[model samples]
Target: MVERKLFAGHAVRRLRRTLALTQAAMAEALDVSPSYLNLIERNQRPLTATLMLRLAETYDFDPRNLGASEPGGGSDAIRRRLADPMFADLEVDRAQVEEWLAGAPGGAEAFARAYDRMGQGGAASDGAPDPASAVRREIERWRNHFADLDAAAEALADELRQGSGDLYSAMAERLRVRHQMSVRILPVEVMPDLLKRIDLHARQVQLSESLEPASRSFALAERLAQEAQGEIEALVRGAGLDRLGERLYRRHLTGYFAAALMMPYARFLRACEATGHDVELLMRRFGATWEQVAHRLTTLQRVGARGLPFFMLRTDRAGQVSKRYAGASGSPLADAPGLCPLWGAFDAFERQGDVAVQLAELEDGSRWLTLARVVQPQGARAGGVRARFAVVLGLSASDAATLASARGLDLRGVAVPIGLGCRACTRPDCPQRSAAPGGRARLVNDRETGLSPFGFAGD
Candidate 1:
């Protein structure tokens, strides 16, 4: 048997920089010569098991993280980026991509960022930033968790004495007593175009009667999040967003605060574990909607008592993604331009109100346990038409044992092959291929057609 050498120089260098330690200092701490440390940092020497143990003991670092790739600098991301038509003539190979990532992860990350910006239509001609992309990146950077907001919300939840009575009533009482505000459930006819409205003169937070109990409670929580304006505003100011992006980020933070208040991190995590992450059970327990529960599940990133790191995506029938959070799962599907049609998110529309579970295998052979369910927005109705979306929550299939949703599944069976999207997917035999792969040349024949509509020459 051959042993695989761990050449994680980039990770070591990054760790050293993060600790603000010079190479000599780190080498001294590791009880290694400076020349040997230099060789290790240059990938000329492999990281030994003993050194890994030392690192864990000395720095309280997880050795497993050494094998982890930087965001957007992984070989898979590089390959996907190279699949773009713009790189067709480059002839870059997987080995080269891996080598680049290993040798200079920083440069690889810069390249990834440039490629992503180009994919997002590049920078504005007038030098203006794309606010939506900026906000998404900001959320991704935080891994969808705001510790300060979570702490504040948990404290506020305790103050409200949540378990003693209904949360909505408690929130309303708090508002009335502290803020001198009143809560009113107005008929839809009275506020035809609004779900929630705050009247300063009336000193009332008016909610449309169409809102469900959960939504009404959320509205009250949102209003209460304003009391934590200083915290949310501090995060917003540090986000480096322009006026529009700042506004959007502020709204996102407000929503985060509201969800945290509704679920209260410590208690919600306990419920999630006790129920095996049953979304419906959580909805009933927390007085939240299905979508809200799914969204909250993505934000369960508290340090010591963390739940499963789930990536979430909300898409419509047309396959348009309305919301996405990668969380800590690091699944490329969260960042894909288009989702695979074969994924259960699309199947969810066929079985509305039922959870559709899929053990989806991406082109890179990474398996994810996905739970998809169709949800109709609370007040999204017009002329008798209801707007619907599929909320898909996923985590690495290896964690299926901890996931109740994946119970009774055949983990060893042939998994459903999915991909990032048709454009970047390299699966030559996928019947559902909508577009020819980006860098492949079409193999046109007059006499025959393959299983796929678009056949291309193999690499």
Candidate 2:
């Protein structure tokens, strides 16, 4: 069932041994602890771009064979193995599990093997989940999106898939290959030739003579957008998923295709199934940063096939919502549009790029299997301008039933309130209201003596 393009977990582990370096020695050389080195060897931690570079420089290792793509199962097997019952008495946190996964890959395996034999006593299942059922569940979860898009894009992809106008055309074709849509990227060289003049009648775009590189790139994208308009519109129509907030939902779906193309659905779905949903494996398999993988997981609800229903969100350093891909169920974060004070775990990134996993209950009664990590994005080329991005992955309350982490609390009635602000939020106890939802209105001051941000009638 494993794809050839995917990097093998055991293969990577074997690479570490082939080098003749012990875990402790490698850890010392890498300026990381022994445990961390072990995790990378076991494919628990993504041999990240940073770690991959370091391994090559220090150990004369060739990580390219490990590739930007990776095979997913080895690590998932490791995780399920770790949950073995022999340690049923021993309590373990997911973060601690990840840290060990990151640093002591091989040792983690040994420990898991020991734990498995001692506890599980032959608990492994022989059969894989029915691929068809997985697909059907995914379709139902996504509400039947694939059929509609396939029906709509069939003709367009056939026609435009062969056209070779620009990078956008090429990018569109790439999308077609993956999603059967004629979507392609606009290359840098010819981006300037694209004109902004939109022909509404023919849906053709004429390029202006003066655009620079960035503008041309955008223009080509604009034209591609125009060319694919009918198809895109047809896709939305085809999706049987009814949404609570239709406008916002549509805008989000439009973004979904963009994100999906950036991280193709089939490649990603297969990888997740193979990796057993190991976040690190997905990251490595896609050559995407941790944030990208986190964002991608949320979009799995697209085609209604092969996906675990989940809500995924992300925040930045100042707690701004840099990205949120919450399909039918939107992100839980509120208060700040770009910056959210609510998602505090992302703050851990400044410490040492560690992954923090938690089962959190929002003010509203929602439970989440939250995985957070810090990531620094290198510029387009090597050593380009780098910016750190915080990534968070979340699954709804019910889906977290198997994880024994959350405290013994019935999360069914729990409510995590989310709103624009005090004026809009209607939560009277908020002390940090900077502005009212509407005009200058004053309400009760729960923290102070006189008034809150939405104070009683001008205070």
Candidate 3:
């Protein structure tokens, strides 16, 4: 068999720049001549296995990352973006898109961002970035894993476990002892609009009485995570976000810390593997909710002790995505403005509380194993209207064999064809398309209509 040489020049250059090392200095550290190192960085030479081992040993970085494509900047994403109606006249091809990504990744990212801005009603008039999008980008850039926070939360979890009580009791006790604060579950009438509030003057962490036991524990953990303000702030600062963006990101980081505390990395991973990535089983073991477990699954990218590289999406009934995290799966579904109605997430609402699984094939021929379920948000009024949501967790179908959720399934069977959205999708024969595809000429005939409402010129 011919050896597949790794041409990861951009990754090498990125690493070199991140280490703040001159080419010559990096070359010396890698035990390679500067000229050869330059060749390696320029794609003129393949990164040999021996050199990969040396790079890992000397730099203490993940070798796998050298070959991983940037999220939302891969050739598939670029090709999909170029398929927009605005670029239809350009007639960009797959090879050209791959060349662009390979030769100038930064340029490709800029193009993707510009296209995204156009899709989102063009760049801001005042040039202010959207805080939500900015924060999502930062999370994607980190593959939804913060190692330092994970470590800190794991250590805290160990300390909390030392107490001879439930996790929530232990956390409350720690708060009372360490921070001189007591937890009080106030009645709904007392706190009608607030789920949780920290009264500094009274030295109490007050939560609404309507909160479930799991939510109560999560609220306490979120408060406890604030104790790591220094570390979390350091990350927020490093994100280089605007004021609102920083605040939003800090909240997200606090939630991450809470999740990590609730489901410590090592123990959670073991439970997942043992249960075949069963969401309900993990929730039962960790005293968490389904949404919490699904979200935590996406953050198990902790290097050597990694879990499945799951990507999660949470959307309302109308398909408005509220949260998305594309771990290491490189799934573009997380980046789409809207989801295809044909995906399993929509079906989850119909099944309501039952797990819906699908083997979905994208336009780019990538297959994903998606597990979706409907979940009610944590806080709901006693007899008032409540909202429901669908949470979809997916990973590459190639990795589906290891999941208990995917067991006894026909991995080789036909898959449901899905796309990013009606506008961006190029699937011509989809019966569920609500709008005409971007780059296709609509086919009009006086006497004929096809499966899709909007017939278009085929590729």
Model 3 agreement with the true structure over 147-242: per-residue lDDT tens digits: 889999999999888884499999999999999999999988899889999999999999998888889999999999977888899889877788
- The lDDT of each candidate is 0.83, 0.47, 0.82
lDDT of candidate 1 at residue 97, scale 0 to 100: 80
Error of 3 at 67 (Å): 10
User: Tens-digit lDDT track for model 2 on 1-459?
Assistant: 111222234444666578787778767877878887665555455455566677689868755344311221133334333333233234455566655644555666565444333322343354322322222222322432333333333343344435753434564444446434332233434444343454445434444444343333334333334334565665445432334323343444444443343345665677777666777666555444565566556545432353655555555565555454443333333112223244435545755567765555543445655567776532233445546666766666666554333345455654333343243233454565555443334556566773344444431
List model 1 lDDT by residue over 1-459, tens digit each: 124466778888989999999999999999999999988887778999899989999999977566543445355545655655556557788788867866777888777666555545355665656777677766775778888899999999998984457789899998999999999999878987799999999999999998999999999999999889998998898777889989999999999999999999999999988998999999999999988999999998765577787889999988889898887776878777667899888999999789999999997788989999999876655676788899999988876666788788877677899987787777888989988877788888889988897988777
Worst 10 residues of 3 by lDDT: 67-76
Using TM-score as the measure, name the better of candidate 2 and candidate 3. 3
Show the colliding residue pairs in model 1: none
TM-score of every candidate: 0.83, 0.39, 0.88
lDDT of 3: 0.82
Which residue ranges in model 3 land beyond 4 Å of their true spot?
Answer: 1-8, 11-25, 43-98, 112-127
Error of 3 at 166 (Å): 1.2
Please give the distance, in angstroms, between residue 403's alpha carbon in candidate 1 and its true position after superposition: 2.1
lDDT of 2 at 16: 57
Which candidate's lDDT is highest? 1
